[model samples]
Target chain A: MAITLTRTRRKKIHAIFVYLFLIVSSAATVLPLLWMISTSLKSGDIIFQIPPKWIPNDFHWENYYRAVTDIPFFLYLKNTVLITFFRVFAEVFMSAFVAYGFARFHFPGKNIWFLILLSTIMLPGEVTMIPVFLMFSELGWINTFKPLIVPAFFGGQAVFVFLLRQYFLTIPRELEEAALMDGASRFQIFYKIFLPLSKPALITIGIFSFQGSWNDLLGPLMYLNDSNKFTLQLGLAMFNGMTKVEWGPLMAASILVLLPTLIIFFAMQKYFVEGISVTGIKG
Target chain B: MKKLKKYEGFLFISPWILGFFIFTVFPISFAFYIGFTDWNSFTEPKFIGFDNYIHLFKDDNFLNSLKVTVVYAIFAIPLGIISSLTIAVIVNMKVKGIYFFRTALYLPAVVSGVSIALLWRWILDPDYGLINLILSYIGISGPNWLGDPSWVLPSYVMMAIWGAGGGMLTYLAGLQEISRSLYESAEIDGANGWVKFRHITLPMLTPVIFYNLVMGIIGAFRKFNDAYIIGGAGNQGQFYMVYLYENAFTYYKMGYATAMAWVLFLIILLLTLLVFKTSPLWVFYSGEVEGTKNKPNR
Candidate 1:
């Protein structure tokens, strides 16, 4: 009886330990974000108070208003939206077209081209940064969104193409064969058949592309010389001066910048989780 | 019919073909050409073969940046892998509110890089930071995390760990793919939890582990925005890529920067190949034979 009691006690301890681990790790993961929101709401004096208050006595709604007007936040938002929309649209369409080719068709140099496409995934972007910058400069495209938006149209993302290809491959060949037999051309087959089946993959790629372009800083920083052309990420980056940083405004702007992504993520959490799983399965 | 389909395939794929030629292939070739020539914004290009490469060998800042990058990668990757795997394993168990826990853990990942970096900078503030305040309660003083050079990389590492939720999610999926039968068999043999994990879970998770490792290495090398945001102008936390950027853009040492870029490329390529070669030995896939299939098209 004592042994059984001890065994039950041990199991309870194990369960408690697991719960404690989960709770602590979850807190550690979430604390910084909570702190950001907390600090953003606090007054300047309260921000620097020792034993750093987790909640503000009075929430400063003015900080958000000030952050927007202080910088060209609207312009940054406009640029980010435009860039993200067009870039993601282009990447999805182009990646689907390219991935279909690899998945369905047998063409000359197919293997070689496929290899080249995949090899780019392994090549660090830093390696091509200088030349790409120089190329854009020579074309007089610097300081414009052209450099940012143009490459995206041309099947620029290897990972997206790869993901789409894997998704396309999983689609039973019988569907395509049937479409072909029904006097459907390859384009029609792609559009009417494979395209419809690949919605999840398309959404996944769209979300990834949107998130990537919206959050990208280095590309804008490298190409755009004009402060007016700044994206949201670059605009937020400008808040950091040498010694002193405006923590309140920075956090405020950060909150503004982070909100859209978070909203999208939470709204589509299931799709995002499924998308990541699909990509990982292929990997 | 096959021949016609092949032509159609080429036509469909022409955008990528054109892109490869125009963007990737052309830019890479251009990068190679520029690496041998000295040209700032004002001056015309002057061919000076191997001079940029020669200078790179002697540059102390480049070497130090490399060291910093290596250190950052080492810490970030292992810590990311361990924490993510641990979280994944814990969450994999049939527990209540698993989805909520997963979403909470992944919330940081959806946070913007700039926002997170800014948040962490505040959190790591020596005087007023929450981290320091927490440390003080334990009678241990926290050093200047982002301010001090020694602590900056680790601070970044801590921030990276906070966002390990995506990696954790991937690992969770991998863990789910692992066969339950293996665990049951191990249990029947009187194996403890640790032994089952060591023998069964670890081996089965190797493929995902390999996947994450490759992704982590690539990510570590390309890490830029966080350092740029945190370090500001003077390159305090100037990582390797950040230094490369400064040289290329800030100083207009385009040739030297291109050389640095090439070296980084080669290092990444070598590392990727090394991982690929070594992966077959350890990465366990249940359905397919090891390495008989072609490389993944990605």
Candidate 2:
């Protein structure tokens, strides 16, 4: 009876321990973000106070207003939206088309082209930075959105193509075959059938592309010289350095810059999870 | 009918093919050609065979950048894999509110890189930072994480772990695919939990492990934004890519930078091939039939 009692108590202790660990780790994961919000609302002096306060006495709402008007925030926002929209559209459409070809066709050099595409996935964008920059420069595309948006249209992102191809392969061939027998053209079948079914994969690619282009500072910083052409990320960096690094405004701008990606992430959370699960199964 | 269908397929795929040729194939071939020549923005190309490659071997900053990159990859990849797997395993338990826990863990990954990095910069501020305050409770003085070269990579490692939600999600999916029947059988055989996990879970997870390893290595090699933002100009945190950027834009050493680019390409290619070569020994495909001459099932 004593042994049984001890065993039950030990199990209870272990359960409690596991719960404690989960809670602590989750808190640690979330604390930085919570603190960021808290600090952003605090006044400058209160932000750097020793023994940090959890909440501010006064909510400085003006910082957000200041973050916008201080820079050409509207211009930067417009550029980010424009570039991200085009980039995501191109990446999803082009990658889907290419992925379909890879999935369905048995043409000559198919394996080689597929290998080439995969190889490009391993090639670091940084390594290709200089030569690509020079190429864009030669084309007089510097200071424009061309360098950022054009390559995306070409299925430059091999990972997205690879992912879409994997998803497409899993789709039953009978669907395409049925469409074919109905006198439907390949394009019509792709548009009417494959695309509608691949909405999850497309959404996944769209979110990924949007997050990438929206937050990309390096590409815009590298290719665009004029401040007017700056994306939200580059604009945020400029905000950081404009004389006195105003923590409140900086944090506010950071949050604003982060909002779109966060909204998209939550909105399409299901598809994103599904897409990753599909990829993970193969991996 | 088949011949015309094939023609339709070709027409459907023409946009990608044309774009591939004009953008990818052309630029890639052009990049290689540029690497072999000394062409400034204004001047015509003067073929300077092997000069840029030779120069790269002697560059100290380039060598340091390589060392930093390797160090970062070594730390981040293994640590990220372990932490992510551990979280996935824990969350896979038949616990209440498991979905909430998963979402909470994954929230960081969805947060923008710039925001997270900025948050960390504040958190690791040495004096007034929350991390230091937490460490103070334990009577340990925390170093200036991002400012100090010794702690810079480790700080980034911490940041990487915070964003390990993506890998954790992948691992969770992999864990779910694991057969519950195997666990039941192991229990029936009087095998302990640890033994069952070691023999069953670990072996079954090898394919997912291999996938994460490849992705993590590639990602670590391409570490940019975090390091770039943290280190900035005049800081030793300038990663290999950052140095490549500086050379290309700051110093206008386009040819030299291009050569460095090729070297990076080779390194990544070799690493990928190495992973593939070793994958067959460990990566178990569920559909792979034994003792057959047929190609392994997709």
Candidate 3:
């Protein structure tokens, strides 16, 4: 009885230690973000105050206003949204379309084609980045959204196809066969059945691709030269360059830049986590 | 009609097939040709075979960038995997408010790249930064993180550790997939928590660990945005991709950059192949013959 009592007490102690560690680590994870928000709200003088304030005495909310006004914030936002929309749309719908092909169809060299697709997922973009840049420059598409947006239409991303293909495979063939017997075309069945059934998977990739395009710095940095065409990420980089010392407004701008993805992630938190787990574990 | 039906799958996948040639195959082949020449995107291409590849071995910038990247990878990959796996283990405990902990821990990773770089720049500020301020409370001055040469890699490593929770969910999924029956069987055999973890949990989680290892390697090599934004003094933080970008755009050494890209690809491939070759030895897949157990069976 005494041994069992000590064992339960030891387990209790262990639980306490685990919770304590979790609390501390979670705070460490979130502290910088909270500090960013805190720094954003502080007036210029207090930002450098020793023993930084978690909550400032006076909330200078104009830092957000200044952050927007100092750069073309809304313009960058619009550009980012446009790029993200086109890319995500193409990636989501088109990847589903192509995945359906690989999922449901029998064709010559299907396994070979699937293997090629898988290899593309593993192939780094750096190898092709230069020549592709050259190709775009040759076509006079530099400083244009075409380079960022157009290639997404081709097959979305190979990873997206892989993800959607996996999802599509899990879908039963009975529905498709039933639709075929009822005289539905493959395209019709795909549009009407597979796409609807895979809403969670579609939304998952939608969020993933949206985050990819929206937060992409190198693509916009490489392709879009004109300020008007600058995405939010590039604009943030440019903002850092123009005003290296403006911490308050810079933090404010940083918050503004990350807000969309943050919101999307939290709103669709389930799909986000599911998408990551699926790719990480299953890949 | 029969013939058309036979090619229907091709019709569905034609976009990717076309894109594979245009965006992937053609450019890679073009990059191969370009890697041999001295073209600046403007002048007529002067064919200087293998010159850029030869020059890469001798270039100081290339060599430094390679060192920085490799050193950073060495520290970051192991530190990141351990931190994330530890967090996963901790969070896997059946406890209250675990959901909140998971979400809060993952929030930082959702913040985009440039913003993260910018945030860390301030957070790691030598004077009046949060880290330094916290250090000052204990009567120790924090090192200038992204400023000093020696601290640059450590600074990035710290950032990598902070964001380690980004992989926690995957590890959590792996942890959850572990059957309770294994623990029950181990408990019947009088195994303690640590022993059970060692004998069962860790082995079962090896596949997930293997996956993260490959990804962590790729991520370390391809690290760019943060390194670009938060450059260290004395070019200490000149990562491989940053140098590649500078070579291609800043110096207009397109051919040389492509050579660098090819080298990067090869290095990643070789490392990945090495890991894959060794995976069967360590990565425990459940359910196998007892006699063949722990043997490096293909």
Candidate 4:
């Protein structure tokens, strides 16, 4: 009885240490973000105060207002949304279509083609970046949204295809077999059976593509030279490059830009986590 | 019609096939050809057989950037793996509110790229930056982080560690996949936490570690956005990708930049291949272990 009691006490003590460790580490993890929020609300004078204040005496909401006006925030937001929408639509539909082909069929050279597709994942984009930019320039697509949106319609990312294909393979063949027996076309089977049935997989890939298209910087930076065509990432980079950096408004702008991704992540936290694990394990 | 039926799969994947040729094959071939020439965007192509590649070996900027990137990768990859694995183990504990901690830790990774770079610029500010402010309270003066050449690599490493929680979900998944039966058997044999962790958890987590290692190598080499935004003193922060970008855009040395990109690709390939070759020694697959059990003890 005495030994069991001592063991239980030890376990309780261990639990306390574990909780304390988690609390302290998580606080550390979130410190910089919290500081950004606090700094965003502080007036210009207090932003760089000697002993930096965690909570300012006066909250300056004008910083967010300035962040919008100073950088053409709404225009950039629209541009970003436009590109993201097209890319998301393309990636969600096209990637799954390609994945379904790989999952369902066994044509000659299919394995070779699939291997090439898989190999492209390891091929760094930088190798193709310069030439592709020149190719777009030759086609008079530079400084437009075409370069950003067009490629996504083709196959999207190979990673997205691979994920969807893995998901598609797990779906039972019996359903497709039954549909075929009823004289349904392959296209009809794909549309009626596979598409609706793979909602979770589709949703996961959709979220991934949405995040990728939204957060992309290099794509916009390389393709779009016009201020009007600037995505939010390019706009933010331009804002940061200004001669005199306004710490307060900049932080506010940063917060606003990051808000969408944060909301998506928190709201769809399960899919995000699951998607990552899937990629990590399988890739 | 009968022959066409065998090729029906091509219809579904035709988009990828078209993209593969136009986007992948064509650009890569063009890039390779361009690397053998001196073609500024405005000028006619002048063939320069391997001059750019040869010059890169002796180029101070190329050498410095390569050295800086290699050094950063050396420290950051190991540190990142350790921190992330540690966070995963902690978060994997069957404690209440652990999900909240997981979410909080992962929050930064989701808010990556430009915002992260801008935020870190303030956090590492020498004067009134968060690090200095905190340091002053403890009577320990912090060095000029981004401004000091010596401190620049460490600053980037710090940022890498800060985002280490980005990889935590993978390790968590790996941890969860580990069979409870293995731990139960270890417990029955009177093993302590450290012993169980050393014998079971570490081996089981190797595949996850291996995956992260490959990714970490690629990420460290391809780092550009933050390096471009928050530059270090004396060009110490001019990572390989940043230099490649500058060469292409700022200098308009398209051919030379293409050569650099090729070189970067080769380096990554070699490193990744090296890891794969060495993986068999350390990475333990459960199926392979079962096969080995049938053989006599070495």
Candidate 5:
């Protein structure tokens, strides 16, 4: 009995240690973000004070106002929304359209085409960077939204197609056959049946596309030359430049830049986690 | 009717087929063509015949960028795998309120990249920054993180591991797939925790590790936003993409940039192929015969 008691006590101690370790690391993960928020609320003088304050005595909420005035926040916000909308729309609708063809049909060289699609998912953007840039430049599409938005119309991204294809495969074929028996066209069946059935998967890719285009900096930096056309990410970067320091407004702008994705992630947290797990397992 | 139905499939997929040709195949081949030329977006791309590639052999910035990128991959990939795996294992436990812990760790992953860099830049400030403040509490001074060349790569490594939680969900999914019977059997044999983890857990997780490893290489080579944001002091943090970006856009050396981009691609492809060639020896799945598991052709 005493020996069993000692083993239980040891196991209890082990559990306690595990919790301690987890809590500490979790604190480390979140402290910087918390500090960013804290700094955003502080006035300019206190930002450099020793032993930083987690909660400032006075929350200078005007820093957010200053952040906007420092750069054209709403203009950039409009640009970001425009880019994200078209990209996500293409990513959801076009990827689903193409994925339906792959998943439902058994055509010649289907397996080979599917393999080609898979390989493209693994292909990084660097390979096509320069030539694509040159293509846009030659077409005089640089400094316009066309370079960022047009290519997305065809297939959006290969990974989303792959995901939707996998999800579509799980849908029973009998449903489609029934639709066909009822004299539904292929496009009608696709639009009404497959797309509606895969709501969760569609939402998953929509969120992915939304998040990707929203936070993308390099694309806008490379393609968009006009300041009015800058995305929120590129605008947020303007807070700190070559010869100045503006920590408060910078942190405030960082918060603004972070808010959209944060809201999207938390609101659609379920789909986000599911998409990640599904991609991980399938990959 | 059958012929019409058969042709419908072709019509449905034609958009993607067209996209593949235009955005993918044409550009890759065009990049190859440009890599051998002296194109600068002004005059015609004069065919230079490997001169651009040969010039890169003597380019210091190219060599330094390659070295920085390789050094980063070496530290970031393995350390990232381990840190994320550790977080995954702990979160996989049956502890109470573990959901909160998972959320906290993953919050950074969802946060915007430039925002994260901005936040970290402040946190790592040598004076009056949160990290240095903590260091000073223990009577130690923190080095200037992005400002010092020697410390910049390590600072990036620290950032890489912080975002390691991004892969935690993947590892968690991988862990959930491990059979409970294996652990039960190991326990019956009087195997200790470390022994069971080493023998059973690590091997089972190798496939996920392999996936993350391949992704790690690709991501490390393509790392840009942070480097661009922080502006790696003394060129210490000038990753391949940053240098490539500057060459292509800033300097208008489109041909040289394309050559650099192709080299990066080849490096990634060769490394990936090398990993695949060796994966059969390590990555295992269930119900496999001896030495013939992943080797299909053999």
Candidate 6:
């Protein structure tokens, strides 16, 4: 009786410790973000105070107002939204299109071709990024969204194609063969059958694509020279550069820029967890 | 019919093939050529025949940046992976309110741009910055995070680890795949948590660890945006990619930049290959056990 009782008690203690560890680490994780929020709401004096006003007595909400009013917030938001929407649209659709080809077809050189596609992921963007920029420059596609958005239509990301291909391969050939028996074309099989069935994979791709393009800084920073064409990421960077050292409004704007990703993440948490596990990582 | 259908496959995958040519193949080949030239955007690339490659060794900035990147990766990779694994183990617990903990940790990873922006604001404020203020409360003063050359790499490492909770989910997926029966049997044998983790958990997680290690190395080597945005005290913050960016865009030294890029690519490839080569020794697969040759599945 004593041994059984102690063992159960030990289990209870273990549970409690687990909870404690979770609570402490979560706090550590949340602290930086909370600090950003706290500093954003603070007036300059409270912000500069050595002890730090974490929950500022003075709620200077005007920092948020100033952040929007002082900069081209709406313009930047629009530019980011447009570029992100198109990139995600093209990337998801085209990646799946190409993925279906690799998974279903047995064309001549298909193995070698797919191998080439996989090798592309091995080569870091830094290698080709310079040459790609030079190509765009020669084409006078600089200062536009062309450099950022166009290549996505051509299976721009090898990882996505690989991801979707893996998902497609899992589905039995018999599933698609039925549609083929009905005299449906290959495109029809992909569009009507494979795509609808692969909703989870497609949604995962969409979420990641949206996340990548929305948060992208380098692509926009490199290509878009015009202020009006600047994505929100570039705008935020510019806001920091232009302001020099204002933490209040900058933090506020940072919070604002972060909202979309946060919303998308919460809404589609399941797909995201699945996506990252499948892909290893975005880099 | 077989030949016709086989030819049709080309039509489906043509977009990428075309994209491969215009965006990838051409650029890669051109980049190789550009590495030997002296192009600066305004003029045609003049054949310099390995001058750029020779000059790379002479470029103090490139060497310094590479050293900084390698050093940053040394600290960031192990710490980042350990922290991520720790979080993954914690959150994998079937505790109540685990979802909330996972959400809290994972949310910051996706919040990329704003996090980068806020990292600067919170770290750079000498008196009011969160780090300094926290330090003062603890009876210690913080060094200037972005302004000090010595503190710059550490600052980036700190921020990268802060957002590493994003990696926990990948580890969770890996953990879930490990059959609970292994642990159940281990537990019945009177194995403790540490023993089960060391023997079963770590070995089972080798593939995921391998994946994360390779990806992490590549990422650390190419890490740019954060460093570029919060450029460290002086040029101390100039990472390899940042230096490459400056040479490529800012200076329009396309040839030199392309050469730097090819070198960076080789470094990444060689390192990745080295890890992969070493992986078989440490990375145990579930199916392939001791003294077996490399299996096709592996």
Q: Which candidate should be chosen as best, given TM-score against the real structure?
A: 3
After superposition, which runs of candidate 1 have C-alpha atoms over 4 Å from their true positions? A1-7, A242-244, A279-283, B1-4, B232-236, B287-298
Per-residue lDDT tens digits for candidate 2, residues A1-283, read: 9989997998787678767767776888888888788877878888888878878888988888877988888999999899998998898888888787778877656778788777666666655566577778878899999999988777536788788888888899898888889898767877798789988888877888888888887898798789999998888876765667677777887888898898999999888777776654332
The lDDT ranking, best first, is 3, 4, 5, 6, 1, 2
Of 1 and 6, which scores higher on lDDT? 6
In angstroms, give how far residue A30 of model 6 lies from its true place: 0.9
**Candidate 6 structure quality by residue, lDDT tens digits, A18-50:** 888788878877888888888789887776776
Better of 1 and 6 by DockQ: 1
Computed on alpha carbons, the lDDT of every model, listed in order, comes to: 0.81, 0.78, 0.88, 0.88, 0.85, 0.83
Q: Chain B alone, model 3: TM-score? A: 0.95
CA displacement after TM-score superposition, residue B36 of candidate 5 (Å): 1.2
Q: In candidate 3, what are the lDDT values of residues A184-213, reduced to their tens digit?
A: 999999999988888778877887788889
Q: How badly does each model clash, as a count of residue pairs?
A: 0, 0, 0, 0, 0, 0
lDDT accuracy of residue A49 in candidate 2: 88
Per-residue lDDT tens digits for candidate 1, residues A1-283, read: 9989998998888888888988998888887778888877877777888777788888987888878998899999998898888888899899998899889888789899888888777677776777777888889999999999999888758878877888888899998888778898888988888878877678777777778888998999998879889898888888765356767777888899989988887777677667666665332
lDDT of 3 by residue, B68-132 (tens): 99999999999999999999999888799998897877775677679989999999999879999
**Candidate 5: which pairs clash?**
none
Sliding window of 10 residues with minimal summed lDDT for model 2 chain A: A274-283
| Pairs in steric clash, model 2 | none
For A150-212, candidate 5 gives per-residue lDDT tens digits of 999887688888888878888999999999999999999999999888777787778778878
- In terms of docking quality, model 2 is medium
What TM-score would candidate 4 get against the native? 0.96
Interface RMSD of every predicted model, in angstroms: 1.9, 2.6, 1.8, 1.7, 1.8, 2.2
Give Cα distance to truth, residue A101, candidate 5, Å.
Answer: 1.0
lDDT of 4 by residue, B1-298 (tens): 9898888898999999999999999999999999998988888889999999998999999999999999999999999999999999989999999888988887766788788899999999999788888888899999999999999999999999888887787788778877788898899999988899999899888878888999999999999989988999999999999999999998999999999999999999999999999998998765555422221110
Stretches > 4 Å off in candidate 4: A273-283, B290-298
CA displacement after TM-score superposition, residue A54 of candidate 2 (Å): 1.6
Instruction: Give the Cα error of residue B37 in candidate 2, in Å.
Output: 3.6
Worst 10 residues of 5 chain A by lDDT: A274-283
DockQ of 1: 0.69
